[model samples]
Structure formats: C-alpha cells, structure tokens
Target chain A: MSNKKNALWHLPLIIIGIIALLPVIFMISNSFKTLQESYQSILSVIPNKPTIDNYTTLNHQVNLVRLVWNTFFMATLVTVGKLFTGLLAAYAFRYYQFKHKNLIYLLFVATIFVPFTIVMIPNYLVIAKLNLLNSVIGVALPQLCDATGIMIFLKTMEKIPGSLFDSLKIDNIPNRRIFFNIVLPILKPSIISVGAMFFINSWNEYVWPTLILKDKSSFTLPLALQNYISSEGGTNFPLAMALSSIMIVVPLIIYLIFQRYILNSISNSGLK
Target chain B: MHNNKKILPFLYLMPTGILLTIFMIIPIIYTFYLSFFDWNLIAPTKDFVGMRNYIEVFTDPVNQKVLMNTFFYIILLLVLNFIVPYVISLVVKFFIKRMQGAYKIIFFIPSLFSLVVGAMIFSWLLNPVSGPVAFLFRESGFVLPNWTNSGGLAIIVICLITNWKVFGYNFILLLTGLGSIPKNIVDATTVDRIPKWRMIWNIVLPMNKSIAIYVLILTIVQGLQYVFTPINVITTGGPYYGSSNVLYHTYLNAFVLYKTGNASALAITTFLIFLVLLYLEIKFVEGRSRYE
Candidate 1:
C-alpha cells in the first residue's frame, strides 16, 4: 500500500515536470526546422527535414556574435563592479567600528526595498544628461550598486566567530591584508554564489537595457532578441526560435555549472 | 583616533555611496521632482503641472482600468504564483524522494532565460496560426483563440507565464523552509502516529509561517510589475487596457506616451503604496515573532 502511495504521489510531479520543460524542448526542436517546416510542423516534436536556414538568416539580419559579445561585456562589467562594491562595503561593515555605521548600513540595504520604477525615470534622465544614452557604459553604470549582495555578505560574515578576526588583529595584520588573506578565503563560497547571482540577474535584465539602448549595434542579447521577435514575428517562426535558443545559452551554462552555489545561497538567504 | 578610524570606513563606503546616490538616491529625488512637471521629452523646458498630473491619474478612466487590472494581477499572482507553488513545493518534499534534482532543474531553466525570451517562446506556443496548441486543437476540430488578443485571457496567460518563470524560485525558498524544520519535530509527529496530511497541516504549515509570510510579502510587492514583461512583449497591454497593470501602464506613460509627469506621479504613488504594505507586513511579522 505504501509503495503504491509513493507511485501515486510521483505521478503528478512527472507530469508537471514535463509540462514545465515543454517551451524549452519546443524552442530547441523547432530551431532546427525550416521556417516553412516550423510553421507547418506545428504539432510535431521532431522535424522531418532539419535545416540550419533560420540561424544563417539570424546571422545575416543582425550581428549575432557582436550582440553576444556586448551582452558578455556588460554582464562582466556589472558582475565585477557589483562584487567589488559589495566586498568593500561588506568588509567595512563587518570588520570595523565607525560613527553612524549602523545608519549607513541601513541606508545601503534600504535601496533593496525601493522598487526600480521609483528610480527608472531619473536614471534615464541622468544617463541622457550625461550623454551616455545609447552607449554600453550608460547601460551598465547605474547598476553597479550591490545592496543585495552586501546584505547577504553581511549576514554570512556575522556568523563567523569573532575570535577569527580577533586572532588576525592580534597578529597586527592590516585591514586590507586581513581582508585578502583571511576574510576572502572564508567567504569564498558566498562570493562565488552571490557573484553568480549578480551575473545572472545582469545578464537577464531587459527592461532597463530596452530603455537605455536605442542603436541596434549596441543592443544586448535580450534587447536584440526582443527586437528580433517584435520585428520578425509570424513571418520567421524558426528564426525567432533560433534567437530564443541562442539567447539563453550563456545563462543556461552558468546556471548548470554554478547551480549548487546558486541554490545554496537562495536557500540560505531566502529562508532567513 | 576616532576621526582616523572613521576615515577608513568612510573610504570603504565611498564607492557604494557614490554609485547608489547617483543611481538610486538622486534619481528618486528627480522622479519626485519630475512628478510636478509636465515633460514631454522634447521641449527645452518642462511645464509646471502642480498636482494636475496627480489629479489626472486619480480621475482618468484609463487609470481606473489600470488600477483594476493591477488588483486582478496581484490576486492571480498570489493564487497562481505563491499559493500553487507553495503547495507544489510541499508535495514535492513529501513525495518523490529520488528525482528531486530533475524536477528542480526543469522548473528552474525558464527562470535562467530572460523574460523577453520566455515571452517570445510562449508567444509562439500560443500563436493562433502556427502554434502547437492551435495545431493540436485544429486537428481535433477545435480552434484556440488568439490568446494575446483577448484582454482577460491575455492577463491570465501573462500571469500563468509569470508563475511559470517564477515558481521555481519560490519552490526553492519553500523547500529550504521545509528543510530547515527540526528533524526531531518531524520524527515526533511520525512517532505520534500522525497521518501525513494531518502532520503537514497541524505541524508543517505552522512551522513554515515566516517563509510563507516572506513569500506573501514579496508577491504583494512585486506582483504588479511581475506581469510587465509578458504584457509588454506579448500583448503590449492591449485589448483596450484589459491586460495593463499599473507598472506597464506607468512604462507606457513615460516611454510610449511621453507623459513623464504622469508616469512619475504614478510611480511615486505605487512606491508609497508598496512602502505602506511592506511596513504593515513587517509589523505583522514582528508581532508574530514576539509569540515565538
């Protein structure tokens, strides 16, 4: 009876899991079809005659390589900038005693509560005023603050025994040296996990990039992909599908590789 | 000595302080300032509207529809995204011991993709002419309506897609919530000969209150904007404002309509509303914590 009960419970999960994967499976499978075949073979999972025409067409329509590079460039800059800011701020808040420290720390975390909409317009105006609009720097500069990471790092840092820091202080180690030699090594897991989260969020960002980037050449993959879909919808289903497939490549790879860290961080931070 | 110590921490804070003030603080102030002026994004100077835009946002029929749609969106999100996912997480935890990894990966893959891509993929699936669903239904002598063309259906579809891309995050959150429960408490219930369903209700649910509250507050705060991607990409908040939530409506006001004053006012109002909601949620959570 218990064995049967387990099977019964498992049945819905199996169904739901397959349902969840349908769009991904469809996207990959349909990308290989000709536009005509993609439209015609609507219900078919496998194409009768797979073709690479859509990808070639996509390459011709837009510089796929350049778009991917732009995306990588922006995501990398954001990751590095956020991690640097978060590291310094978290380290300062963790290790030092200073006037108004609690107040400053609260201010840092307070940004997390404010919706992006509150700042979206002014951010655009600032970027426009600075003449960074339609530039990659404009797209990246406003996003470098890492309130979420600092909060996570601060929490993680608090759990470490004070004796560890006290011993390092007893050795007369400077703050910078202690940060590099001791703190970083201990917080390696958090850095990796939080760093990956930052990278993924930056990479997948769309609305802000859409608001900032106007020139097609400056378009990140999500923006470019959105342009492709809106511009080419209904006519080239296969090409659109190809674009979708390519767009998720880096993020999918990152998630697969760092999933353990990512999941660990999510569980750790979210539950607490 | 005190001054010297203060200098180091301040230096450590400089980067974040500079960036956030420029990006977050200054812009927020600017948004508030802009809310008073009618800036169409063209003229050399903005016209001082002096609460005119706020009055329009409150009195306009289109804004009324937006308010309703936002309410509906939040309700659907709570039901589909929060409650359903929480239940699914519980079910997954209770059953299916072996294939947990597979289930999580599959659910999570969509979230890794940008919302734009996810919207496009689903758009293709729901396409009336060449979509798989259409084709399947057409084969059975039934036709699938253009899902994005209908206002009500579009909102529902957008909410469903939002849940699809999002539920994985909440699932992981709840999974961890369940994981963090004391093993001894669970074992005690089992030894007490409690039925699984009874144990889940009487013990598990109550124990997971904080995480549930966390999820609830997040949904309330984010639910308005969560539908933006799908509404923008799929329907463009169309079918006569049926699918337009306040966030998307705000986006249209500033970007599409160039009504910067209206958008800013709308944004500020939305922020203030959410701030109150957040405060109340914290108060309730804190109140509950006192009992613990």
Candidate 2:
C-alpha cells in the first residue's frame, strides 16, 4: 500500500522545514552572538564567541523575573478558570436532558465565533470602570471562560459511554458522585491537553493585555519582549533575541512533552 | 435533594453562561450602544451623533482604505494559510510516504509559539538594512527594500511572519484529514485505474470536505486575527495607515485616538461582516456538502 518513492521531493520538503524553523534558529544563534559578531555574521547559526552580555543587558532593561511571573500567573489563572467552568458545563450537557439544552449549548458555541476585537473596547471600559487597569487580574478576568475548553471537553465526554452514567443513575447515585468518581479519571488526559492549549493561548495573548496591563511589572514576557516594538525598548538586537529565547522556553518544553496528545486533540477537533 | 435533577444541570451551566454573558453578550450589546455616540473617553458629554459615525466609517478615506486592506488580508490569508497548506497536506498524504513524522514535527514546532513572538523574531530576521537577507543583498551590490515603508510590502511582511507560524499548524490539520481518508476508497480508485489527480479531485477531496471547510473557515476566522500581533509589532499599520486591518484599526481608534464612538461603529461593522461571512460559509460551503 505504499506509494512510489521520490528523493527529489525530499529536497523541497526539507527546504520548507528549514524555512519554517528559520526564526527559531536565528533566535537561538543570534542571542549568544556579540553585537559585533551579530552585525558581522548575519548569516551564522553558531556564534563564533558566545557571550552572556545580551542577557545581562536585557536583565537591566526589564525585570525579566516579574515579566515571566506575570505571564505565568495570568496564563495559569485563565487555564484553571476556563477548565473549571468548561468541565462543569460539559458534564451537565453530556448527562442531562434539561430545558433549552440545545439552546444553551449553542450559546456556548456561539461565543467561540465572536472575535475579540468586536468586544474589546466595551470590555476595556468595563475593566476601567471596575478600576482593574494596569493589573494582571484585568488581563485574566475576561479570558476565564473559553468556549474552546467546553467544546474540547464535550468532545472528550463523548467517548465515555452513556450507559456508564445511566447505570449509575438507576442505582440512585447522585450525578455529582458519577462525575467526580468516574468522569474525572477518564477525562484526565483530555484535561491536560485542553489545559496545555489554554495555557499556551493565554501566554501568547497580546491585544487584550496591551489594553489592560500598562505598567512594566504587569507586563508579560510578550510585552517585555516588545521593547523592540517601540523604539523605547532600544535598538539592541541580541538582547531582544535573548528575551525571545527566554519567553519561548516554557511553551517549547510544554509543547514537546505534550506534542503527541496536543496533535491528536487538534486533529480530532478539526474533524468535527 | 430530589429537586437536584432540575437544578444541578443549570447550576453546572451557570458559570459558563454568566461568564459568557458578562464578557461576550453584554459587551457586544454595549459596543453597539456606544457606536451611536461620539465620546473621547474623558470628555464630559457624549454627543448623540446618530448615523454620522456610520457615515464616517463609510466615507472616511482612511477607514475606506483600511476596509479594502482587510479584504486583501482575507484573500491573501486564504491563499497562503488555507489553500497552500491544504495542497501541501494533500501532496504529502498521498505522494511522499517517507519521513512524514519529520515533516509534521518540523511544521508543528513553530505553531507552539506565539504569533507575537513570531512577529518579533520576523522583525529582527527581515530587518532591511542589516538582516541576513539584507546582508546577502549588500554582497550582491544591491540594497534591500524596506518592507515597513511600503503599504503592500508591509502587509506582505506581516502576513508572511504570521504565515511562518500558522502554515505548519494548518498543514498538520489538513494532513491529518487527508490521512484519515480510508485506504479502501483509494484502492477502489486504483481498481478502476483512476489517475491520482482525478481520484484526489473526486474521491479523496469530497470525503475530506467537512474538515477542509472547517480549516477554510478557520483560516478566515483566526487568520485575520493573527495579523493583529504582526501589525502591532512590525508595522503598527504605518507608512500612512497602510497595513491596518479592522482588528488593529479598532484598537488604534479606540485606545489611541480615544474616538470610542468611531471605534465602536467600526467594530460593530466588522462583526456584522464576519457574521454574514460565517452565515454564508455555513450556508454555502458547509451546506453544499449535505447533498453529496
């Protein structure tokens, strides 16, 4: 059942792979290069004489510790919040035949299609009115309820046979018991994959946070890395790359560890 | 506790419902309400401008051009992110059989990082004066063109950076869909001596249409959204508002200009556009599949 082999096709695919990874390669290599070397050998993947100077310069320019902490706190808050809400709602939908059941589920799904840009301004005013501006809570609050979590959880719940829950129901077991005792254990992998997605999305988030978190202490790594966005961050190339390298390390590790599960979840989700 | 049957389901649904209401539904309604008034945030009064803001959205040259640019962004995104990746997945799935995992991993690595980070790395890599490409050009006795300075090139630069991040992701999704197509179908095509291209165009494609449409719709839905980070990082819709799309333009108008009214009007307008676009997509692209 194998198709014809062609070595020529491998060349183009390999080239595309390199193109895909060029920025990452550039970031890693250039972060260690001296300013002189960076400018001199713009094409090099390995630094001739690597130095820690760029990391130190970036350390002085911004509080890298606070930036990482801020991003981690906000992303974790979002992931936990979304996962908690999503799990409860998904369990209810899967087990119950409540009134407006279809309508309520549709409502959750509808939120997925509402682009953030449309609602951002109003949300800003609301956040400002509540005086949450320049705060990590401001960034985390609006993101807490993601429909993607509910969607993913619901899809996972589909794998748990209805008879499992129904048999428990005939035994006069409370739904809560069934959910905590049975569904929870079965759902551990789905939870991890969904949590990974939620964490990564919130970590990578920029626009909403830009509107909310104004102070340097409140700035996430993305915000911190964005000194180059404005000239105010200065024209230090290697330093910026150093910041990027630091920012990506956590997500890269999480991604590698969860790559198989994440890919399966995405492909499975994509099908339906 | 006997009443738990009616109540527990709702209680479970409550948190999600309330959060979505506060964040999504109410905010959307509030945005529409704000669209009618002219206010600069700190101003004491909001002038009831009626249709004037909508009129401005229609007639303002900058807004008009930005609207056009958003259209171009949609088309370019479809080409680069949707069509290109789907084609790659098709070719890879049916043709090249070796090292598929290597290709998938290579593509998926970039998808794990943020578009904002991608934008920054891209900005550094594509630096016109002193970047690697620029360095290459200098060796050839030619100067590299500044992408940020030109409107079209700036848009292209922004999309390409985004393309670097998303192309692999969408490729993986479509490739998975192509791979999931049953082997027996392809075998039947072989029994009839159907050519690869025709079999693909007829059998494999039709079978994969739903996921294909999902990815297609996603390319428009999330694709334009990806432009926000790159537009912010790289161009800031600069060179005279050249690369700005509706998403970032809304941010600029509301936050930067403090023209909250106009921003709301623009937001509501774009929301409607996307809604209609989605309806049409579901009705047309998704609807057509049922008959087959």
Candidate 3:
C-alpha cells in the first residue's frame, strides 16, 4: 500500500515534466505541418497532415544545407580545439609539476567565470583586426580554448591512480607519447561528454555569433534561426519551427547518445 | 631529466596559453584601457578621456534604466532559473524515484535548444493575436495584452523564455549535486522518522548547499547573458531600451552605436561589480560550507 502511494507521487512531476516539453513537442509537430495547417490548428500537437513541404521551403529560402554544414564545421572545429588544448593543459597540470602551476591552473579556471560581456567588444575588435569578421573561422577561433573542458579533464584525471603515471615516468617515455597512448584511452568518456558540451554550446551559441556572423552564408545554426525569426517580421511561424527543429536536431541527437554521462557529469562540466 | 620535466609542461601549456592570452586575458585588460578612451570603431584618431565614459554611465538616465532593468533580470532569473529549478530537482529526486531517467531527460529537453529558439517559440505561443494561449483567453472573453509592445511585459517575456531554456539544465545540475550525497545519510533521515520538511531543511539543504551556492552564483552572473539572445532576437531592447540589461546595452553601445568608450566603460564596470559579488559569494557561502 505504501509503495503504491509512493508511485502515485510520480504523477504530478510526470505531468509537469511533460508540460515543460510542450514547446519542444509543438516545434517538432508543427515542423511537419503545412503553413496553413500550422495556423489552422495552432493548438493541435499532431499535424493534421504531415508534410515535408515546410523543410523544403526552408531549405530553398534559407540555404539550409550550407548553414547546417557551416554550423557543423564551426562546432566541430571548436570542439576539437577545446579538447586538444584542454587535454594538454589538464595533462600538464596533472602530471608535470611546474612553478606557480597551481596559480596558473587557478587562473585558467578563473577564465571560466569571466562574463561574456567583458570579452565581447575587445574580442570583436581583435577578430576584425585579424580580418576575420563575417568569417566562420572567426566564430570558431576565439572559443578554441575552454577552461571548463580543462576542469572536466582535471576532475577525470583525479580518478586515475597516480601510480599509473609514476610507472610511465620511470619508463622514460616522452610525455607526449604517454598522453597519446595512456591518457587518451582512459579519459575517453570524459572527453566525449566535454566534446559534446563544446559542440552543442557552439551549435546553440547566439550572442557571439550574432556579432561576428553578418554574412548570410556564414551564419551558424542559432544565427540562421534568429535571422528567420527577426527578418520574417516574426510571423513566419511554420518556417521558424522547421528551422528550429533543424537547429535543435543535432543537440537532441547528442543528448540522447550521451544522456547517461551528460546527466552524471554536469556538475563538473561547465560550458561558458 | 629534471630539465625536461619543467620544459615539457610549458610545451604542453603553450597552445592553451596563447589562445587564452588573445581571447580572455588581453581582452580583459584591453577593455579597461579602452574605457579611458574616446575612440570610435571607424575613427582614425583616439582621444584620451579618463573616466568620462564611466561618469556618463552613472549619470545617463537611459543607462540608469538599463541598470535598473539589469537588477530586475537578476532577481527574476534567480527565482525562475535558480530557485525554482532547485526546488524541482529536490522534488523529482525525492518524490519521483520511479522513471527518474524519464524526468531527467524530459526536464532537460528544453535546455537542449537555444535561447533564441526558445524565444521564437514562446513569442508565438504567447503572442496576443492568434496564439493558442491568447485564443484561450479570448474564448474566456478577454484580450491578452501584446507583450512585445509593452516594456515591462517584454522583460517578462524574455525572462520566461530564458527560464524555459535554463530551468532544466539547472535542475539536472542540482540533481547531480544531490545525487552525490551518500545514500546512507539519506536513508538515516527516513529511519529516524524525521518529518519530510525538517529532514530536507536540516539535512538535505545543508548537504547540498555548496553546489547550490555555485548554481546560485551562476544564476546571478549569467542572468544577463541568458537574456541577451532573447532580447536581441525579438525585442532589440525595445519599447525604447525598456527590456535591455547591462550586457546587451554594452554590446549595442559598442557594436551598434560605435560608442566603444562608453561600451568599454560599461563592460569593465559590470565586470568589477560581478567580481565583487563572486568574491562575496566565495567568502561567505563557500567559506561556511563545512561539508565541502
């Protein structure tokens, strides 16, 4: 009887949780609906007649393929950049002892909390000076190093017994070789979660991309999606939904694939 | 061997060091330096204008409103994005033990999308004309006020949009923190027959306080950022600077209006204010987190 009562307690939370995802459901469902059907059945979740028309319209109108490809490229570049640099920084912090290492690592960690506003203008100027404005590389360049990825890796390394490294040290192996051969395999899961975080963050990043990405073809997913909303006079609901669905699809897939680790490791994983 | 040890570490650090210096460190210092200049982005000559921009930030009535709007964003975001999520995490963790994975994934779904996307979805759903909610209101015989036209309502609409994107991620974060508490300690509360509220207050909250404080500080510091995309997407800080916060205003001043000096001053001032807040949080909250 008591167990049954406890089961009943799940109802309110389940209802609220489903309710929370209403907009997500709405976005997905409406993406399949015709533009007329979308407004005709505003509250209806399931499209009266599912069609790929909206997506085709969106593709031709927004050059969706180019935007998706550019977004994918930028996001991947950032993920790779952050992972590579973050791994090296964390490895050095973990393995080799250097003077003021703790202070330096703390400084790296401190960068995690520096508000975006403080960096926005100056970084923009620097990127422009580099003649990279309105270029996809410009969007990817500034975010190439993430302090949070370093934090996540450091936390992951804390679990690997120090004896493993000590043995490698005794063998006179190069640190680079040991990092590639040993640390890479061991930190795979942490790397994946952190990489997914970087990818998804870059994918969903709006403000910085908004500033740098002025050219239509260069706009990342968020920038492209925002363009749809703002330029359409905010009334092109069906097209926006279709674009949003496309925008969210990558993160959605990432979430499903990494759900277990993403949930478990969010406390340690900070995405700036 | 000893020589290799020191040099190797520096070698490993160089790439990260270079990136951080360009992107984070120098930019911060540059912001402070620019705050003293009367320079436009396109202008050839730069004039030194020591602290005048900072004075303008304080005295300009428009900026005063921006500052006030920023405080409102901070307070409302704390409730929606921070406290509400914390409470929801507790409820889901404790009460909804069954299908916890379902709850976690479902709650976190909204967070998977961008704030710009969230803003777009919500502006439609809550639009006064031909919107689902507005239609419902009309059926009940009243017109819903158009939020985009009104300044206060615009701020609220943006906040709700941020909350939609932020709530689940924060819930998952707090849930993870709560999950780290040893099961035996939680079991002890049940065995003692402690009332639920008291157990939560006397035990659960104290134990989870450190991560909670981190999340709280994140809420305070990130509030403006979370609002940025939404405002930029839909409002443009409109109804005439009604919905703008410090960060957005800073971005606009520098990028949109070419007032680099004013923007830099605003940016540095905002940075220092947040730095002080973070210091206080570390001093007071983390200092007292004995469990940590």
Candidate 4:
C-alpha cells in the first residue's frame, strides 16, 4: 500500500519534468536549422539538413565578442559597487544605534517598490543633461545604490553576534577597521549571495539600457541581440534563434561557474 | 562616547537615505506632479491641466480595454507562476534528496538568461511557419495556433515563456523551505504510517505558508514588469490593440503620442494598484507571522 502511494506521488513530477525540458530541447534543435527548413516545419526536433550557417551569419552581423564584453563590464561594475556600498551600510546598521535609524531603514526598503517606469523619463533627462547618455556609467549609475542589496546585506549582518564587536573594541580597533578586517570576512557568504543577485539582475537588464544607450557600439548583449532581430526583420527565425542561443549560453556559463555560491546565497537570503 | 556612537549610525545611513529620497521618493512625487500637467520634453513651457489627463484616460474605451488586459494578463501570470513552480519544486524534492545542489543548478539556468533572450528563444520555438510547436502539431495532424497573431493566445504565450524563464528561482526557494523542515517531525509522521500525500498536504504545505505568500507577492511584482519587455518585442501590443496592456498604453502615450500628462496619469494608476497589492501582502504576511 505504501509502495503504491509513493509511485503515484512520483508520477506528476516525472511528467512535469519532461514538460519543463521540452522547450529547451526545442530551442537547441531549432538553432541548427536552415531558414527555409526551419520555416518548412516549425516543430522539427532534428533539422533535415542541420547547418551552422545561422551561427556564422549571427557572428558576422553582430560582434558577439564585443557584446559579451559590454555585458560583463556593466554587470561586474554594478555588482562590485553594490557589494561595497551595501556592506558599508549593512555594517553600520548592524553594529551601531542612532536616532531615526529605523525610520531611515524603513524609507530605504520602501523604495524597493518604486517601479523603474516611474523614473525612466527623469532618469533619461538627468543622464542626457550630464552628457552621460550612451555611456556604460550612465547605465551603471542608477543601479549602484539598489535598496534590495542594502536589505539583504543588513539582514545578514544582523545575525553576527554583538560580542564580536565588543571583542574588537577591546583590541582597540576602530569600528571602520573592524568592519573592513573582521566583519567583512565573516560576511563573505552574504556578499557572494548579494553579488550573484546583483550580477544576474544587472546582466538581464534591458529597458534602462535600451532607453539610455542609443549608440550601437555601446549596446549590451540583450540590446544588441534585440537590434539584430528587429533590424534583420523578425522572419529570420533561424538567425534569431542562433543569436539567442549565444545569449543564453554566456549566462549559463557564468551561472554554472558560480552555481553553488549562487544557490547557497539565494537559500540563505531568507527571500523565500 | 554614547553620543558619538549614536551620531555615527546616522552618518552611515545618510548616504542611502538621501539617495533613496532624491531618486525614489522624489520621482514618485514628481510622477504625480507630472500627471497633472501637459508637459512634453520638447516643449519649453508646461500648461497645468488639472484632472484632464485622468478624465481622458478613464473615459477612453481603448484605455479601458488596456486596463482590463493588464489585469487579465497579470491574473493569468499569477496562476502560472504559482502552480508551475510549486509542482516543479515538489518533483525536484522527490528525485534528488542527496543531490539537491546539482538539481538546483540545472533548474536555475533559465532564470539567469535575459528576458529579451528568453523571449527571442520562445518566439522562435513558437514560430507558426517553421517553428518547433508548429512542426509538432503538423506532424501530429493538427493545425498550429498562430500564437503571435492571436491577441489572447499571444499574452498566454508570453506568460508561459516568462514562467519557464523564472520558475526555477521560485522552485529553489520552495526547495529550501522544504529542506528546513525538522527531520524529527517527518520521522514521527512516517512512523505513524501517514501516507506521503497526507503528510505533505497536512504537514509540509501548512508549514511553508509564509514562503508561499512571499512567492505570491514577488510574482505579482514581477508580472507587472514582464509587460515592459514582451510588449516591446513580440506584438508591440498589436493586432488592432488586442495585446495593448496598461503599461504598453502608457508607453505609447508618452513616446508615440507625446502625451506626457496622460502617460503619467496611467503610471500613477498602475502604481496605486501595486501599492494596494503590496500593502495587502504585508498585512497578510504580518498577520500570519503573529499567528505562527
């Protein structure tokens, strides 16, 4: 009776797993097809005559290497900035008490809900006025002080014992010194977690980059790929699929490299 | 010493506080302010148009349809986001008890991809003429539905794509919640001969209520933003405005029509809806916490 029940429970999961993987398999197979062949039979899992022309054309049309560099540059800068600023803020909030601290923290977390759409117009105006438009910094600046980063950092910092601060005080260390030397080492996991989140968010960003970045030279991977598709005309389904395959592959590589750390961070962040 | 310590915390928090105030709070207030005026980026001067933009937006039939479409799409996405991830997490929990780490990495690959990229991939997969779905249907002797051409189906396709892209993150969250359950409690239930289904239904699901609510709130927030990308890409909210959602309509108003005031009005309305949903979520979570 127990065996029967367990088997029944496993059925739904097996079916769902196959369903979940179907599209990914379809995407990979479709990427290899010729334009005519792809259009001839949209659902063909195996191309009748598989060709590498789609990838070759994608490479020629868009500088894949440059686009990857642009994306990496922005994501890395934003991730590093958030880690630095967020750690500083988190350490201060965790170790010290001040007037209106709660109120200030409240206001900071509240800003998380402020949608990007509300500020896109003004942000554009500010970036243009500063002559920062079409620059990577212009794209990176708005993301530097993310409230979610602060919240995650502070939450992690709160878990450290007060005794650690007292011991540092006994060692005649200043708060800033203690934060940099001791507290930071202990907060590595949180840093990794928040860094991964920030990197992923920055990497996947499109609307801001699309609005602020006008030069094709400055386009990140997503924007470059979008331009490739729209300009090439959307009918070049195989070429579009090829570019997308490249786009998807880069992030998967990064995530796989840091897969354990990223998952550990997500689970630890208590975001669930 | 106490006074100095107290002041230090304020100094540390000042940077974040001031930045949020200027960038976040001010922009929100300015969105409201902009909504009441007929201002354009090209125009030198602004005319104060009190309630006119709101009136036009509320009265327009197209705006009404867009608003409905927005809510409809959000609802559809909410259901998919909840059900798909929950089922996926459960299956993942069953398969890899010891290899949970490896399973997580496999599932989370999709979430790391950019929305534009994911949409592009799905757009290819769903291509009616020579796409995978169309090919499958043709092979099976069934006609393929023109996903992009059909307004309602296009929205559903967008939601499914979004679900596929992001569900792994949520699944990981649920898996973590499941992992945190005390072993002793599970062992006791098992010894009592409580069936796996009964144990999950009565024990595990109830224990993870908070996590479920968190997922729900996050899903709603994400669902709103999903409109921005899909609208920009696939349909541009088209087929005679069949797919035009509230956010897309606002984009059209500001960028295409150059009606800043009307766009701001639509933005404010959307923000209010989000605000209400957020507040309700907070209250619900807080209430549950107290009970727990």
User: Which candidate, 1 or 3, would have the higher DockQ against the true structure?
Assistant: 1
The full ranking of all candidates by lDDT, starting with the best, is: 3, 2, 1, 4
Cα lDDT listed for each candidate: 0.81, 0.83, 0.83, 0.74
lDDT of 1 by residue, B1-292 (tens): 5576678877988999999888888888889999999998667899998999889878999998888888888888999878988888988887656778777777777778778877887777877887777878998999898866777789888888887788788888888889888888888977998887999998899989877887777776766666787788888899888899888888899999999999998888888878776665456433433111
Candidate 4 or 2, higher DockQ: 2
**Model 4 misplacement above 4 A:** A1-56, B1-3, B90-102, B195-198, B284-292
Better of 1 and 4 by TM-score: 1
As for candidate 1, its clashing pairs are none
For each candidate, what TM-score against the reference? Answer: 0.94, 0.95, 0.95, 0.90
Could you say which candidate leads in TM-score? 2
- Return the lDDT, model 1, position B219: 77
Which is the winner by lDDT between candidate 1 and candidate 4?
1
**lDDT tens digits by residue: candidate 2, A177-268:** 88888999988888888888889888888888888988877898888777665766566678778888998898888888988888777776
Per-residue error for A220 in candidate 3, Å, reads: 1.8
lDDT of 3 by residue, B192-289 (tens): 89887788888889988877877888787777788988899788999889999999999899989999999999998888878876675556443632
What lDDT does candidate 1 reach at residue B88?
86
| Per-residue alpha-carbon lDDT of candidate 4 for residues B1-292, written as tens digits (9 for 90 to 100) | 6677767766776666665666567777887899999987669888998999899878988888888888888788778887677766765664334445555666676777777876777776677886666877998999888877877888888887788777778788777877888878888887998876788889988987877776777777767687668667778888767788877787778777888888889988878877876676556543432111
Alpha-carbon runs more than 4 Å astray in model 1: A99-103, A232-234, B141-143, B284-292
Candidate 3 CAPRI grade: medium
